[model samples]
Target: MGAGRPLEVDLRRVWDAILYINKTGCQWAYLPHDFPPRTTVNYHYIKWMTTGFFARVNAEVRRRVRKKTVETRNRVRGSSTVKASRAPQNLPKNPALTVIKRSRAESIIL
Candidate 1:
């Protein structure tokens, strides 16, 4: 990917760092030690953000997410027959099952 371009730093790593900053709403100086210096991250973020690089990355991410969701839904639909066949008959119906089930489902989907 850097065949022709002069690679200075890892763009993905910088992007992740920027995302972490945005997610946590932390000051640049407060960036964790694992990431590059706050100034470096902030520099690239401002440059990229100004040039719409983040917008492009975001659009691509959304497209991939939608594609994956459709694929997963299709797989689940296709496996519905097997799902019923494998259903446990001895399972007890607990009232708290709904909450647990929802949490598990949310985790899996996310």
Candidate 2:
């Protein structure tokens, strides 16, 4: 059943090129020569994005990292949690304003 042409480029190189472009925010055409061709990298990137391949990989990696960090995570945050002040007392309160009633003529015109 495997009768198609085999992949000539190393998939790792393609992944590396994608990571390089993502990290540097560089244009696909400006990809370094050490990695696979820009076209190949971009093709894989588009395919991965369209098929949610990157999402799946990210979810798996995130799950593993969270599992490993579970023990250390609780210790990082001490017993007391930081609380933000709802109203700051340092600032002066606004001065009361007096509203002048408009003349009867002005009010009628308006």
**Weakest lDDT window of 10 consecutive positions for candidate 1:** 1-10
Q: Taking the tens digit of each residue's C-alpha lDDT, what string does model 2 give over 12-109?
A: 99898999988999898888889988998988889999999999999999999998798567655542233334445497644432222345556788
TM-score of 1: 0.57
> Would you list the clashing residue pairs of candidate 1?
none
> lDDT per model, in order?
0.87, 0.81
lDDT of 2: 0.81
Question: How many residue-pair clashes does candidate 1 contain?
Answer: 0
Per-prediction TM-score to the true structure, in the order listed: 0.57, 0.61
Candidate 2 off by > 4 Å: 1-3, 73-110
Angstrom error of the Cα, residue 82, model 2: value is 29
Question: Which pairs clash in the backbone of model 2?
Answer: none
lDDT of residue 23 for candidate 2 = 96
